[model samples]
Target: MKVRAITGFFFVIVMLGSVLLGPYVFSVFYLILTSFCLFEFYKLVREGGFKPSRESGLINGFLIFLFFAAQCYFPAWKFIFFLPVCLSAVYIQELYKKTPAPFSNLGFTFLGILLAVVPFLFFHAMAFMNGSENFNSHIPLGFLVMLWSNDTGAYLAGRAFGRTKLFERHSPKKTWEGFFGGVIISAVAGLIFSHYYTELTWQQWVTVAVLISCFGTLGDLVESMFKRSINVKDSGGILPGHGGLLDRFDGLLLAAPIVYAYLYFISN
Candidate 1:
């Protein structure tokens, strides 16, 4: 556990430093993480004796991640249109092949894709905005920082002060103390980013803080539900202490699009 902790700390720091540099840096990392996660998801599905089009999943997942990556560099909304089509096609094929219950497994899989893809879109959108204008380009980095901060606070507080369970049935180790700690800590991080990093006002920061606190928690829970449903402990073994790339990115998956949406609305 100690070794895992130490490794996780260093790995996180390096990833943060690299990701914040610009699109090239973050894009490379995002593609790699998504690939690992998609592979893990595919593996889990196959192990369940349900075969999803592995080719489509990999191609679709990679295309989705790369599209967001390019969204940072380009402004084409056309690619975004293909996401649902591609994913739905994957689900439809699966349904026709072995034919699961009406919209049961297929719906589950499609929903999973939405949950996974949209935030990544936001992450990329931030980069594009950053390049196009300097008014709030830092929002992308700020959003990611808060995500890391959320996890850090939750883990530390949960270990130090946690007593009461938050959702004992869904997740055994999660405590209410950790939940509040993550909220407070992420809120603070959001405030600091808005105050010092971006030109956004206090009101904006407060809004961002709330979104991060709420949506980020939802993202984490979503991943947990997937794991629990599949009777798996970790999403993958890619990361040591983190369990998998998906495990580490569970919150960011949701938070990224949310923060982007807030910024987009504000920008417009």
Candidate 2:
């Protein structure tokens, strides 16, 4: 218990610091984060008796993130055009490897990018999402706060009053009661953030909170499903008590894109 608390405290501090420090720090931090998460995904897939193009996948995934990051810093550059060439390399490389299941390799390699990298791309976009190409820490930081609030709220609420299982198949410990608890807490956090951040109106922030709570829960369940399919308990053991970066940020996987879309529409 002490170890979990200590690890969690440092984790929160580092996450908050990364956003508050400014664009360069945030970009570098998430770039490394995206790479690590993709690596972890490919590693797990390999453990599941399948072979994914780890090298090409990592390179392409890094390029994909760089494409988005570059857009924020250097929008005029045509880095996006190179993406197809990079992705095509993945397919072409498989033609020569003569792996037992080339197609599966291809599928999981791309899946790692889609499942692990794409959402983070959206997340990285959130910093400069205001349309001015300027970085604002409020949106990303507030989003993380609400996400953490929802997780904490659900845990506390579930422990207190949790009878009805939300989804017994994928995650049996979750309950509808906990879900609502998370929503209520996240909504409150949104209202609080609106007072200070002002990046979004109160209602918009509340809506984002609701979106995070709902989709974040789904994201957790999806990761849980993936781990179960592979007969593993946690994604990895990088964090002492947190299992893996994926386990820690799984909620952001689905929630980030949805929130980004919502914020983009409103900002425009």
Candidate 3:
């Protein structure tokens, strides 16, 4: 228990520091994060008796993330046109390998990219989401705060009042009680954050909070499903007690993209 608490404390400090430091730190942190996630994902898939193109997928996934980042930083929409061509290299490389399950290889390679790389790419936009051409840490910081709040609330509430299972097959411990508990806590947090982070109104922050709670829970379930299917307990052991990068950021996988879409629509 002490080890877990210690690891979690340092983990939170590093993540929050990177996000708060500035764009370069945030970008570099997430870039390394995305790469590690994709690498770990491919490793898990390989453990499931499938050979994925690890090298090509990693390189292409990194490039794709940079491509999106470039789209945000530079006036380079035309550069995005190269993404398809780069992705195609995965297929093209697979053709020459003479692997029996070429198609399966192709599918999982792209899956890693789509699942790990694509979702996180939108996080870059959150910093510049206001259309003011300036970077604001609060947007992403609020997201982290709400996400952590939901998780903390669910843990406490679920322990205290959990009864009915939310998804018995994928995640046996989750309960509807905990789910709603997380929502209520996150909603309250959103309302409170509105005063300090004035980028959005109270209502908007609440909406974002609800989205994180709902989708974030779903994201946890999805990762649980993946691990269950693969017959693994945790995604990786990078964190002493927190399981893996995927386990930690599973909520962001689905929530970040959806929140990005929501913010984009409202801002534009």
Candidate 4:
């Protein structure tokens, strides 16, 4: 428990620092983070008796992140033309590997980028969602707060009064009670964020919170399903109690994109 607590403390510190330190640090930090998560995903896919193009996948994934990150500054459509070129490399590389499951390798490699890398792109975009060239930390910071609130509330509430299983097949321990508990707590966090951050209205923040809590749970379940399919307990032991980067940021996978879309829609 002590080790877990200590690890979690540093984790929170690093995450908070990354966001608050301005756009350069945030972009650099999450860019590296996106790569790590993609690498981990490919590793897991390999463990599941498949060969994914780890090297090419990582390179292409890095490019994809850069493509999105560059948009915040440049906002040019021509920057996107490179993406197809990078993706084609994955297919061409697989052709020479002589793997029996070449298509499976191709599929999982792309899946790694889609599942692990794309969400962070949306997450990174949140810092510049207001159509400003400058970075605004409020939306990203508030999103993290609500995300943590949901996780903490669900864990506590589920332990205390959990009865009916939420999804017994994928995650046996999750409960419906925990889900609602997370939503309520996240909503409160959103309400609180509205007071401090005027980027979004109170109602909008609350809506963001609700979107995060619900989809965040779905993200967890989806990762749980992936782990079960791979027959692993955790993604990796990179963090003492938290598992891997993938495990830590799994909620962001689904929640970030949805929340980004919502924010973008209302902002525009």
Assess each prediction's global lDDT (C-alpha) against the native: 0.72, 0.93, 0.90, 0.93
Q: What is the C-alpha RMSD of each candidate to the true structure, in Å?
A: 3.2, 1.0, 1.2, 1.0
Q: How many residue pairs clash in each candidate?
A: 0, 0, 0, 0
How much is the lDDT of residue 12 in candidate 3? Answer: 90
Write model 1 residue lDDT over 176-255, tens digit each, in one string: 89988988888888777766865578678767776886788778887888788778888777676768777877887777
Per-candidate TM vs. native?
0.82, 0.97, 0.97, 0.98
What ordering of candidates by TM-score runs from best to worst? 4, 2, 3, 1
Model 3, 1-268: lDDT tens digits are 8989999999999989988998878887888899999999999999988888889999999998887776656687778778788878887788778778988888999999988998788877799785535778998999998999999999989999999999999999999999999999999999999999888999999999999999999999999998999899999999998888999999998999999999999988
Model 4, 153-264: lDDT tens per residue? 9999899889999999999999999999999999999999999898889999999999999999999999999999989999988999889998999889999999999998
The superposed Cα distance between candidate 4 and the true structure at residue 84, in angstroms, equals 1.9
Task: Please give me the total number of clashing residue pairs in predicted model 1.
Answer: 0
Ten contiguous residues with the weakest lDDT in model 1: 128-137
Give per-residue lDDT, candidate 2, residue 162. 98
Q: Over 4 Å off in model 3, which ranges?
A: none
TM-score of 4: 0.98
